[model samples]
Structure formats: structure tokens, C-alpha cells
Target: MVFEYILKKNGLDPSTDLTIDQSISFGLTAAAFTSSDADYTIEFEPFATTLELEGNGSVVASLGTESGYVPYTAYSARKSYIKQHPEVIQSFTNAIQRGLDYVNSHSSEEIAKTISPQFKETPLDKLTQIVERYKAQDTWKEDTVFEESSFELLERILEEAGQLKETVPYKELVTTEFSTKAVK
Candidate 1:
């Protein structure tokens, strides 16, 4: 989506000008680039670190700042599910908020040490670098509330990518009721 947006913003049509192929996974994308099957691949940290560790490639375009695409994670539920289990939603949101708080308060090295065991194949130094990069980018939100401007930017990007037909109002798309309760 960011690719499409960037291309269009630069007055180029992505669909007509670019030969885009979808890879099944980020690892596969990295493999494609490494094998000389593809010229470039869009990837984020940890995985990008893995690619570099394998001596495949280096990150050329850093979207961390230019894209205004921070807070790269979200949780969602079906409207019916949310209506039926509001408390569950609150519980989930609250737990995530607490986790985000812990991450924000702790150093990247501390976070890397805590989560490193789960990613046994990833070297500690690489994992630490990924964590530190994300921390520096302020990738995690301090609270669960969705920011309107960021949401609008996401919608614009999607629209530019032709994934969305029309602009959807933020209130219609997201319910902050649970997030508000969770943050408190």
C-alpha cells in the first residue's frame, strides 16, 4: 500500500509502470531478492535483519519516517463478536495496553532479552537491533486509542492503492469505546 501511495504521489502509476508480484511471505520475498528473481522487496525489521544476516541485501528505502506509517500493529474483532463479548474485548485491549506500556518503559535490550527465547533462530544482536530501531521509531502507541490523522492517512493510502472505493469515516470504521475503557 505504501508502495502504491509513494508511486502515485510521485506521479507514476504503480499498476501500469511497476511489475508487482506478491510473495507468500516476507522470507520468500527476501529469498526472491537473494536469488535474483526480484529486484526489490518491502520488508520491516527483524525479517530485514534476517535478510542482512544471510548477506542477501541491505535496506535501501527506510519507510520508518517518510511514510508516516507508525503504530504498525492493530487488533480487531467482528462487530457481532464485539457486541456479544464487550468485556472480552475490553480485557484483550487492556492486556495489550499493559504490554505496550511495559515495552515503552523498558529499554530495547531488556525487551530483546525477554522475547529472544521465542525467536531462537534469530541472533540476540540482530533481535536487539530490530527492537532498538522500532523503539526509536516510536512504533508502539502508549495507549490503545486510534489517532484520527493516522487513520485518515491509512485510508488515503488504501484509496490510492485502489483497495478502498470511498473514504470511510473513522467513527464508522472504529469503535474506541473499549480502547477508552482499557486505557483508564
Candidate 2:
């Protein structure tokens, strides 16, 4: 969705200007790009860095950078659940803020070393490089607050791609109460 939004933002119609091979499974996109004649591929970390490290492809652009701040990963709960479990929500948000604080406070190499166990197959140096790239791009948000403008932008992206049937008001979909408290 973001990639398509970026394509349209750059004055190209995705349907006519390019072929996006959705047939490739998400996990296999890197491999498919490496093996196939596709000119470009959208990929997430580790895989994207790995591809460049292996000389299979170049890290040409960041869709995250191109699309601006979109909250791609967020903690969500049913309204009923949230109403019933406000404490739980606050605690979870606080934990996420603590994580954000840690990342913001630490050096890329330190953060990479700390997270290396999660990516056992990746070498420490490579992991550090990936972390450096993310840090350079300002990938981590300083706090857990979900900005209304970002929510509106997300809906715009979805609308452009014909993925959003009805736009949900930011107030209806998000609450800054917990994140606000957490950040404080």
C-alpha cells in the first residue's frame, strides 16, 4: 500500500507504470528478486540489508522515508477490551515507551548487540549496520503517541490504493490517553 502510494506520489500510475509481483510470498520477496529479472523489490530489514551484503541488490530507497511517518506497527485492542482493561493498556504502552527510550538513548552498535540474539543467523557487524541504517533514517519514534496527522495520512494512502472503503475518524480509532500518560 505504501509503495503504491509512493509510486502515485511520484507521478506514476502503479497499474500502468510498473508491475508489482504480488505472487511472491512476503518472506520470499528478497529471494525472488535476487533470482528473477525484477528491477526492484520492497523488503523489510535484515533481508534488505542481507541482499545488499550479498551483492544481490542495492538498497536504493526507503519506502518509510518516502511515505513519511506512518505507524505501521501499533498496539491495538477491541473497544470493549480497552474499556475493561485500561490498566493493562497503560502498562503495555508504558513498556513500549520504555523500549523507545532505550533505543533513543543507546548507540546503534549497542542496540544491535542487545538485539543480536533475536537474529541468531545474522552476524554482529551486519546487525550493527542494519541498526545504523534505521537510526540514520530516524525509524524509531521518540514516544508512543500516534499523531492524528499520521493517521490521516495513512487513510489517504489507503484511499489512494482503493483499500479504504470508509475513513475512520482518528479520535474513533486512536486514543492518546495511555501513551500520553506513559510518556509523562
Candidate 3:
């Protein structure tokens, strides 16, 4: 969404010319960064050959998993970064808030169906089960509230790379105004 917003600001029509799923892997600090890290990339031609380039940078910067395994002090570092890169604050917040809204509004079945349809054997049932398990997980929030701990992890990454311009205040970076309409 951030990338699309940037493109739109440049007077580009994303839907007509681009199809982007904006999911950025942020770091704990500006010191933390990743490049060409995505497993796959595509060229301009419609049938262009695909490339596998896990470009560069560390493996990860946060919990590394939604279940919170591989624990690290990333959240702390991410929060500190917000205090530095105020300009990028809104974009970061908007993206998460938008994602959370989509997740909250849809049922596991509906979401799974919309997200991917290539699941293997017994897909519909399996997908439903997966969604149910996801719903059972605790502490799901659909609001956009800039979390210091969460940003701390991102901070460690961007800071290391000297990406921060001005420290952003947590309060200025987020709002729940769209929370109600965000979810289905």
C-alpha cells in the first residue's frame, strides 16, 4: 500500500499497470536492513523468466513468526526508530491498519478463499481448519496503534542502515479512525 501510495502520488495508475502486494519486512533498527531478500522476483516481460534472489542482509529482525518464537529484543529497537524517522511513520501505520482491517472483517473461510486458491488435496476443508485455528489465537487486534515494542524491532534495522530522518512520535504515527470500517 505504501509503495502504491507513492506511485499514486506520482500520478501512476496502479491497477492498470501494476499489481503489488506490499508486505515489507522491516527491521529492529535503521541499522538493520534487507536487500533483494525476497525469494523471488520478476522481470518486465509478461513471460519473462523468473529469478530467485535472496539478495542480501540478515535473515530476519522481529519475532520471526506470528507465534512469537525465536525471541529477540527487536521490538525495542523498532520503537526507538520511530523516535527518529517521523516522515515514514504514517505510511508504516497505514499499511498495518489496512491489513488488520481486512483480517478482522473476514471469516477464516472467506479470507482463506480470497487469499489463495491453490491449496492441495482436500483444500476447502483444510483451509477452513486452518482459519479456525487462526481465529482461536489470542490477542488479535484490528486497530492501528503504533506500538513502541513493535517499532523497536523495526528501529534496530533501519537505524543500522542510517534510514531515519527525524525520530517519530508514536502518537503521531497511528490512529484507529478506520478500525470500524476496516473489518468486514
Candidate 4:
């Protein structure tokens, strides 16, 4: 979506001017681009960084860094589920907050070493580079508050992609009650 938006802004129609092929995995997409199976692919970090490390491809653009796009990772549940499981959600949020705090306080090399076991296929050095890059980019949030600008960007992207029919107010879509409590 970010690439499509960028292409549109640059006066290129992705639907008409480009043959956009979707791959099931980022690794495969990177491989396709490296092998000339696809002209370009939009990839997010860890995987993208790994590809560059392996000399498969180079990053042409970094939407988050270069384009002012604030891409984020989120955890969500249905409103009904949230209401029924507020305590569970609070516990999970608190745990995540603690984890984030740890990551913020630690070195990238330490973090990479700690998490490397989970990614058995990825080299520790490569993972360290990926973590270091993300750290430098300030990709991890220290707090759980959703920035209004980030939400607006997300809404705009969804609308442009025709995935959203009506605008959902931020309050309706996001609940800061748990995050606030967790932070405290």
C-alpha cells in the first residue's frame, strides 16, 4: 500500500503502468526481485535487511524512513472480546510494555542474541544488524499511545486502497484505557 501510494504520488499509475505481483512471503518476494522474476518488491525490515545483507537486493526506498510513513505493529481483538477479556488484555499489554522497556534499555547485540533462538534460520550477525538498524530508526515505541497522525495516515491508506468504505473515528477504533493502565 505504501509503495502504491508512493507510485501514485510520483505520477505513476500502479494499476496501469506496473505489473504488481504479490508474493506470499517477503523472502520469496525478495528472491523474485533478486532473480529478475519481479522488477520490484516492497518489503519490511528484518527480512528486507536480511536480503540486503545476503546481497540479494538493495533497498530502493524505505517508506517509513524516507516517506514519513509511521508503520506500526499492533495487537487487536473484537470489541466484544475486549470487553469480556479486559483483564486478559491488560495483562498482555503490561507484558508487552515490560518487553518494550527491556528492549529500549538493552543493546541491539544483546537483543539479537536473546531472540536469535526463535529465528533459528537467521544468523545472529544478520539479526544484530536488523535490530541495530531498527533501533537507529526508532522503530520501537516506548509507549503504547496511538499518534493521531499515524492513525490518519493509516485511514488514508485504507481509503485509497478502497478497503475502507466509511471513516471510523479513532476513539471508535482504538481504546487507550488499557494502554494507559498498563503504562501506569
Q: Which candidate ranks first by lDDT, i.e. highest? A: 2
Model 1, 1-184: lDDT tens digits are 7877777777878779878887456557666667776777888667787777778877666675667853467677899999999889999999998988889999888999999999898888888988987887767778888888778988888777779898988888788888888778
For model 3, where is the 10-residue window of minimal lDDT?
44-53
Candidate 3 structure quality by residue, lDDT tens digits, 1-184: 2333334545777788664434433322211222333432222111111111222332221113332221122122255665576446545556667766777888878866875555543356456655554556533465654356655545444453357655666556544333333333
Q: For each candidate, give its TM-score against the true structure.
A: 0.84, 0.97, 0.33, 0.85
Q: For model 4, how does the per-residue alpha-carbon lDDT over 49-76 read when each residue is reduced to its tens digit?
A: 8678778777776677654545457788
Selected candidate, larger lDDT, 1 vs 3 = 1
Q: In TM-score terms, which candidate is top?
A: 2
Candidate 1 has what TM-score?
A: 0.84
| lDDT string, candidate 2, 1-184, tens digits | 9999998899999999888889988999999998899999999989999999999999999998999999899788999999999999999999999999999999999999999999999999999999999998989999999999899999999898888999998999899999999999
Model 1 collision count: 0
For model 3, the superposed segments whose C-alpha errors exceed 4 Å read: 1-85, 117-124, 144-184
Per-residue error (Å), model 3, residue 56: 38
Candidate 1 vs candidate 4: the TM-score winner is: 4
The alpha-carbon lDDT assigned to residue 96 of candidate 3 equals 60
